[model samples]
Target chain A: MQNEMVAMLLAGGKGTRLFALTKKVAKPAVYYGGKYRIIDFPLSNAAHSGITRVGVLTQYESVALNNYIGNGSHWGIDGNNSVAGILPPRQTDEGASWYQGTADAIYQNLDFLDNQNPEYVLILSGDHIYKMNYAKMLAYHKEHKADLTVAVLNVSLEEASRFGIMNVNDDYSIYEFEEKPKNPKSTLASMGIYIFTYKTLRDALVKDAKNPDSEHDFGKNIIPDLLAKKKRLFAYTFEGYWKDVGTIASLWEANMDLLDPSDPLRLYKDDDFRILSEDARDLPQFIGKNASVKKSIVNQGAIVLGDVSSSVIFKGAIIEEGATVKDSVIMPGAHVSSGAYINHCIVADNVFIDGSRRENEDGKEVILISK
Target chain B: MPHILGLANLHGAPKLGPITERRSIASTSFLGRYAFVDFTLSNFSNSGIDQMGILVEEKLRSLVRHIGNGVVYNANTKRGFCSIMYNEQYAPAPAYNNDINNLIENHWVLDQSNADYIIFAPCHLLYRMDYRDAIKYHIQKKASVTMIYMKCSDGKNSFINMDELKLDENGRVLEIQKNKGAKKNINVSLETYIISRSKLEEFLEFAKDTSHFFSIRDVLSYMTGQLFIHSYEYQGYLRAFTSVEDYYDFSLEFLNPKVLNELFVPEWPIYTRTNDTPPVRYGEEAKVSNSFVANGSIIEGSVKGSIIGRSVIIEKGAKIENCIVMSDAHIGANAKLKNCIIDRYAQVLHCNDLKGDPKKPLIVRERDIV
Candidate 1:
């Protein structure tokens, strides 16, 4: 299977940091922005960037994610010989095994990559939220005459230590790399997006998989080894909204960012990256005579009879009379019955609260999960 | 699969008052997301009957746009066939539009189709049914024609001017009489008929010299005691929007839960063209209750007891009550409305109050700013 360029997405993270949200669901399968899953962003981005040969490597809780990305028709990546496939860890002749680490995972699937025989490989993470045209990065990689290019986004100095920080010269050639340094020298944090010549990536993965001291990782093992060998590594800067929703607080705040009037990640902004989701086949939302809603993103099939401000309500969720919901995220099928008041909380899908009032004012967000 | 040939606009486009002012009733937007013909097409698709022929009359631009390629109903596939038939010489009139002549005009599709039994349907009767079992019932009895009907309790209101069938104990058609608004268990024709290809060929020759014959109903009506027409009782919900009162009543029927379930169910899903509009967004000051708001709508005022279609904007301080606002209609600030049907993209100016009777809905033509 020969292709122009193939995208390999590592979707193996357990996302334990997201707390109860990812207890049974993969991070990518978590609902976001009212209607879409987290994985829709990157898959939509790659499909729109005209890089259609995508293989998503999954390890944990891939059932929902697998069902969602079927045939990729939601993003219009199903025609003209373009295909998207989900690849889970499977048994080989040796034995059934899981993906040990990022580098080792690709190494185990090296034969799969060779089948495609791509000239260049774009490696990406499945957990990040952003809309970018990777075709531009691919072009920059070809023009730089480099063997490896790392896509980096600028983060705040305080947030730099939470990511793999990369230091590059003025000409944009990487000279030093540190995996989450406490006292970082650069604000250019690694987006964990990599593009490499197929041959270079294959050779590096093979060598890294054989090293006992190595961690079999991209930022921890592969990048350091390549830099040690003086491989031509360049940094590709990206300018847009990017957030790693790895924690509960970060995920909660990231959702609130959609309601921020000044935030650039609003879904209605651009037509090119219109994030597509599964059609829930819901009717239009209904607002009652006394319902007062403000500064919210509400989908179809909702019947609201109370006050809702600064929240995101999914389809089919109902807020009854005398109930008030503010600064909350209510999933589909969740019901806030009459006389109930909720604030700064997350009502999971289909969870119903009886006629009572509960407020979260301890500055710590509350998450309600239905049994 | 039965050879499906639907005679669109069983009447013509010029009737139905302002609803069909621009498009035929077959192409009329119904129930927010579907065209009137979609229910009939969905019946064909769900019943595994592809290879359909739709007789196109005047004002079919919106109908053509909605059924473009017919991929939504799987009529755009290589194996599935969706034929839009046209008659170059056929004319349309309100009281005398002949579907039998339209059939004579597009005889080629009927001739080339592989199926032997033909299912002829009119567009106005909205119901959910599987025509397979009915076709089987027709074949089992070896009947020349099977007329599908329902035991409608509320038929007297709209069918008063139309004809109803009187069936005997054996379910055979006995008599045809004008519905006089006196019966409770009136047998209303659902406008669906199953006849073999040979019988259709015989009717084509029979109707060749009869320019006065309008539909198969015309022939069957006159030969009530002579012809062996069987009646198949359809126990589902049926509403014929032939009159403006029927249309307004049917539009508000979705507010009832039982009617909604009978009209739309998951097993027999209604297929329609999918629009690429965003979800409805409710502003902070918006107050909405007991309404069906479609996708891409923005609400900032109060709405009660209404159906708002796609891309509608209800501006601040506006109050819409018992109104059916179609797609892209704008209810300007403080425009109180009651009992009206706002056409697509029509705007009601600021602070304007409009009202109509519950039996008749006031219509605003498409794209007209009031």
Candidate 2:
């Protein structure tokens, strides 16, 4: 399976719905579950699925993302056979530009995909939080000889219209794909994950680039074009925890899922899944005296001095004495001053909450943007 | 002893007390301020010997979860920080033992940096001492290996014997006897040693041809007559907790303010991965005296002469004396705990009476109830 598939991660989305959290860094670089970034889910899933060669697409401020994922050495993506790299736009015959859409981004970086010459191309969005074995999806795609396989996750009818709804036949063949249709056909939603045959993707991208009317997106242009051509696309149903962390409330809720003392999206339990990032020094996490944490996820390099309940505290965050944090997402280097109370808040890195302030009371969620 | 590479072998050892239940040493073990492995890594980092590797055989989830990037020990740098070298294939055959040398070679490769001096220290031993001074002493004496030694007064089972110690006029070790028995023992090896990088490379080459079961002590014993194997004396508090009693005794030593200060004062800060818990909140009726309470604790009860961990809650009217409460534990109201090491997430119900002797601290593992 070496070099059989190469992954192209679409991490450049502005994620405007995430609000103030994505104000400083790219949406893919948003800190999730204390120690991990939002992009880690896709990168880890891709690596675990035997897709060693990966290229991350970034347009927004990718400094933190680049620093966090330096050369992809942490996920065993070094050496000759395996390589993970960040593919930013460069000057070419097509001219240098930011990624307008997912399909346009892939069309611009066709040279990078062509160099690897993988049999299959696995494209994924970087902002979703879930643990999936993409190898299983790849196996299904291979068995069915699909030109494109879309990872379809089941959602309730209410949430179906929010995603790219997929209408599948009895045999799991995707009959139609609709992007946020008011009148949806089915409850199976495309997770924005597509596995395309290398030739098929390249041809589709080239054709899409020439079409002036196309919006240059997989759901908006490429999938519709593929459907018009009667392409062989199947849906790989996923029955697991999957959440699109597009909004502040959703991101907060996704983090809160980890604190559920029962089953959670267990990224740490999956040995096959590997989070590819720059390796930090491996030191044991320090748990301070007088800390009263329950069902909280804390990363290394965090210094806790107060009470924390059902929260996700990122690496290097400091919760000073007499502070109370509940149902919140505190990023790295964030300081909650003494006697302050933070509830249902998403605090960014390097943010300092003033003493004794309860800003997010009355359940009014706020994303504290770093200055 | 010649220069030797030390593997903590945390997975291989039989742990008693709170350590046995924990996958790795809990981050909130030391009075909820630091992880148990902090003492070992800090000593190595402060010594300026950057080439270090940790061998993890089992319970890797906790180990990986805790040691993310090794930044606490200042090992997170452009140069070699630390690598968790795991054997990829587990082919259960006699020939697999032949690959031990390959594993050692990989360890050497991981530690291949611009460092000149090499030392191996394990996490099982707890002692706060500057190893740089010892390394400096070794270089000045022109010794091939300098093993740190402590004089044990108690007549207990010792791992290394130094009865044949021959010291010069300047108190430098001339020779150390390995197998000799005596009434009064002067030198006992602490298993920590310094060796030149080149000498370690040569030793690796020698071990490649020898039996697969070759121990580090075997190499040390081999170079006894050819090279100058000296000893560096360590006089401060040094205790090896291989047994249950040893761990229990070492834990209770924190009750005394002097011992606690000795371990923490003078700016010898033990660095570990810090958590993001809030400051300990004492309820209106909380009464704490002569105890060390870590951050994120909610103390509504009476805690005296005890060390409580992060996120622990002693409900109203509960009395804890001379106990080590790990993180996320809950002591119900009116419960009495004495001389116990409560593991993480343990819940002592209301009015429960738990007590144990100092030699044998009451052990409650994670998620347990009394």
Candidate 3:
């Protein structure tokens, strides 16, 4: 079957900065926003954009991520005409090998893409928290007749050097691509999203695989190599709430944004733009007679009997009476006993916190409880 | 080991005043997020009874929509089916519509199922049980029909308008009498019957020749002494919804953790259709106590002793006490609502004080803009 576009989600990153939360699971499978995983954002965005096929490449701690993305029906990407598949490293005529890098991951799955025969390929990172329509970017790439288009977000000048800077011309045509330059030339930073003509991407991947000295990375090798060859590269500016939840602090901040009334990332939308996830089959949240919750988000299966403020509580979490939670993110199945107080912390799944074993840190740092 | 087919019979459901005006009692919203039928359907699925049929008496639109494809209930798409059977010919005639007649109307369910026994249950009386153990007891006793009942100590106040059974020493039901709330301790019938398929065919034929108005309950009452009928005691959480007052009181009783824990088991999970919605967001001014809040709700007010459904918005300064607000309801700012039942998509705006008596709670109809 011939498809206009197919999304290839890169979900194999081992988020070490998230600490013990990603010790057993991949970065994409980390719990986020009470009821969803981080990968749900990109998968839901692809589905909402009407992309029919998706191939997710998994490497580090891929079992959970692979299981969660089975057939992609949770995002409504599985049906008679549409397909969602998990592509892992496999043994071939050459030999058994793991995915080397971002470019190498797609290079290894060229046979799978050839089977779908898609004209355009959308490369997505599964760890970011954002909502963008890839179809609009694809339309822009087609209209400009460019070989490649990278989604860019206008960051502040000070933060520009922290990201891969895209130096573009007046017409948004990219002239140079720098990976975290000391003296940044532009505020337009690459959002790690890219769309390319299938033939162009496939040829570049084959050439990159042949180079022994190449790092086989997308931002480091392929993108710069394409720019050095003077290929048509353009920047598609995306103006929305985007967050790279690469660290514990960033993940906590992203969760806190959901509780903010004026936050731009509105999850309580009434339209078709909804972030879909797996159903945990939980009952409605129950708040006890003594509970007081403010500026917080609580999901189903949670039973709250304490004072909660500025927090995000996931499914099956419990806060007993006399326990106070403030400025925290309680993952699924975590329990806080009575007389315990938690502040500015990220309680991992299944962790039990009590008064005697409480972790009371200053508001300056975010405490992580995985035990 | 008999091949049993489950039937969720909605014919005996009582009219719950305005709450059930547009929908059947089977489809009535319960506990903020589930329909009354979800409990019965979940029972079948959890009990490993794959083939089941829902006999709809009336008001089927909401029920049909809620049980779409029956996928949430783990219904088998190929072999076993979750069929919603409605009698179109006699649907307009309530007196002529009964489970016995509906079975005869949709005879394909009985004809196609390769089963030796059929379990008929009700939606109005919500409970959780594995019918496999009940079937084993029925088969071992060699009873022609098995009736499930519970021992109610508070019979005077609860289980009103339901059936009470008079049993013999051998656990045989001597008589099926209606509960008039005359006794404090009595055996209340749950209206769940397990009958052999051949015997079910005979009862259908008997009711057809008796009268068009004769329901299956009447048939069971008539043949109580003649058939080898037995009663099986079910000891668990069970609530009967016979009137609007009963619905109001029983729903509030679940606020107690002890009572709620008896119904919600960890291993035996109750399944319902899931709306992929975000978690409930409570604003800075929110104060909630003793409430069940579903997902996608935005609360900026004070809610005490209430059940808030999905996507409901409670604006700042609004006070909701002892109310049942359904999905997509909007309570405007400073609106004070007490002892009210707001239906789905209803907006209680510009009405500062809308209170009702605790005995008879007020109901705002579906999609009503007040």
* TM values, all candidates: 0.87, 0.67, 0.97
Q: Under CAPRI classification, how is model 3 graded? A: high
Misplaced by over 4 Å in model 2 are A78-80, A92-95, A169-172, A264-291, A300-303, A366-371, B1-243, B251-355, B362-370
Fraction of native contacts in model 2? Answer: 0.00
CAPRI quality of model 1: acceptable
Instruction: Output the lDDT of residue B278, model 2.
Output: 34
| lDDT on C-alpha atoms for all candidate structures | 0.78, 0.71, 0.91
Q: In candidate 1, residue B170 scores what lDDT? A: 89
Tell how far residue B367 is off in model 1, in angstroms.
Answer: 3.5
Q: Give the TM-score of chain B in candidate 2.
A: 0.83
lDDT of 2 by residue, A115-159 (tens): 988999999989898888788888999999999999998888888
lDDT per residue (tens digit) for residues B12-40 in model 3: 68888888989998888888888998899
List of clashing residue pairs for candidate 1: A284-B293, A287-B288, A287-B289, A288-B288, A288-B289, A293-B284, A294-B284
Give the best candidate by lDDT.
3
lDDT of 1: 0.78
Interface CA RMSD, all predictions: 2.6, 9.5, 0.6
- How much DockQ does model 3 earn? 0.89
lDDT of 2 at B233: 85
TM-score of 2: 0.67
Ranking by DockQ: 3, 1, 2
